[model samples]
Target: MPRPLENLRVVDFTHALAGPYATNVLAQLGAEVIKVESPHGDLFRAYGDDRELAKLGMGIPFVGSNAGKKSVSLDLKKEEAREIVRKLIAESDIVVENMRPGTIKRLGFSYEVCKELRPDIIYCSISGYGQEGPMRDYPAIDNVVQATSGMMMVSGSEEDPPIRVGVPAADTYTATMAALAILAATTQRARFGTGQFIDVAMMDASLIFMYGSTAQYAATGAEHKRTGNMGFSGQPTSGLFRCSDGHLVSLGVVQHNQWVTFCKAAKREDLLEDPRFNTIYDRIDNAPALVEIIEQLFLTKTGEEWERQLSLGGVPCGMIRTVSEAMELEQVKQRNLRVPLNIPGMPNADLGVLGTGFLFAEDGPAVDGPPPFLSENGEEILSMLGYSNQQIADFLASGILQPSKKPETAK
Candidate 1:
């Protein structure tokens, strides 16, 4: 069985979370991704707090997103090094860069330059704002984008300060969007025999992730309200509640029948006849009283017990578990969301990484190899591009290329 992107080559000039994550998805889908790094390395290679890992440029953050790819370090300031990039792009199917807008152009590998090298290339540029906008020149990272995209504003309660999401939501979502755009461009090129230049802005992608809220505001001129620990459905029945076992359970009793079913599950069906809590409108109007009664009812059982009871009784609900706890579940193990990952010089470590979200029936997404050390595959890549051994050695000797720095200690 062959993976979807098998034999396709990508010239990756991206680094950090968003760009590398996009290429990581392509690598999982079986593309031969050639990660072009500076003579130093990607900034993210030293991003994590682990001293040993960062020393070897194999930080957890870097390894998490860079598996199944080849690495080649070249200082593009040198004309010879830039020529090498041109040659690689000439033979590659796609080119991806996440440098601040115009930075790649200054390096002379803009889409126009890439088009001359490979006319049908799919060039994707991921940036903080966009290729051409008032704020295009401004730099941005996940936190900055989150704050600027109105995401933080909708996260916390009215009394609380805006809360930044725990994870890099903007970067994560933008990566997925970039991957989708690249694949769409690939399909379009196959049909029309033309290339595409895709510009993905983190701010734009962040807003798109909150499309429903934005759309509602656009349509009704009503701003979204932040309801802490409460579900977006706006029903009093749908929210988080603490149970007797000191665990929290999230309930999804949005519909009228679900509310009724929940009351029945708790053997409190008398609430259905209560005028103040009978209809959805009445429940909304009398939310304080209704929530107080429901909270007391949930306190009678453990979170797990309530989950099983409500779920079996046709109400959507689940216990809120920590990430580690959730990972321990049988369902998580069976889903194959997490795959074994082995990085160079870390053979004894028990490492696992996530693949793409979706799976195929056969030849599905998978990591073909471990994450590369800096310039780990430079010689091989150069050879594949028709460079002789002597030429590769010369490039290495002249500081045009940086050799990989594999860790000496195996653990």
Candidate 2:
């Protein structure tokens, strides 16, 4: 089948999550993504290992953003390597890099140079604070960005300390958003003969996630706080309640009629006539008593029992499942959320490699082959550039060409 963007070429200079994540999405969409790395490889190859698990390049994090792409190793510090990158840009449709603001420019591959070579090129720069900002040079990570943007302040319980999210939510999300912008730019260029640069800031993305709170704070100086299991503004019938099986279930259908319907469905008809909980604001004023009412009624039924009941009655509610439970969910698994791909080149050669985390139209890309051994494609790539075996040997001997060194985990 002919895939979208199948003819497009992308040069990826990003490392870790932010840059590689964006490039990974492009690769899944059928772009020819060339993942350029240093000789030592992306730092992510070594991430997430502790004393016991530290046998080799675990490559867990690296695998997430590097699937469905070809890798090439080049040291940009060398002028010869810089020329290689420039030549690559001249042939590529898009370039994605996540370096400090001036790093690429110093390497002589600035946006202007890139556009000069390919006027219709879409160039995206992912950074901590964005270019042209006061703190553009400052360092950033997910936790610090969340704290600076007051995201953690609004997560978890109000009484508990600010907590970072369990996942790389900010980095991964920002990567998606940046990729969206790059695609948009590409579309605009194709349609109108124009291309431009895109700058994405993780902090800015975090702030956008909490725009409503930031707007309210700007207008009235009120801070949004952490409310454990309770909806903001203390709305009744909009929180987690305990089920008979000792599981937590959330109910977020806040419409007044839904409240009435929920009470009937839960067999708590007496609450309809109760004066203290008659109106929305009235219930808000008496949240504690109303919560106590819902909690007691909810505990009468098991989690699955209440789920079916609420779903049938059109009341938004469900269980507070852990990651394992969610992965094993019937509907989720049926949707192929956790589709398995075999580790390429492992002893079990019958299994193929898994490409990307997402699917398009139906299933994600069928990897078609195992993850290539490091430098497995080096000879082929050089030959494609019209280099003979003798020249290729010279480049390799001069350290101008690097075949891949399999990370420890590859063995």
lDDT of 1 by residue, 1-411 (tens): 888889899999999999999999999999999999998899988878776777778888998999889999998889999998889999999999999999999999999999999999999999999999899999999999999999998876778898999999999999999999999998899899999999999998998999867888889999888877777778988888999999999988888988888888878989999999878899999999999998898899999999898889888999998899998899888888888876645733568888797878888999887788899889899999999999999999998988876656542
lDDT of 2: 0.75
Error (Å) of candidate 2 at residue 189 is 1.4
Residue 201's lDDT within candidate 2 is 92
Q: Name the top TM-score candidate.
A: 1
lDDT of 2 by residue, 252-355 (tens): 85778988888888877888999998889889899889888788888899988998898798888888899879878998766555435455434332422224
Q: Global lDDT of each model?
A: 0.90, 0.75
- Candidate 2: pairs in clash: 375-404
Mark the regions of model 1 whose C-alpha exceeds 4 Å error after superposition. 408-411
At residue 197, candidate 1 shows an lDDT of 97
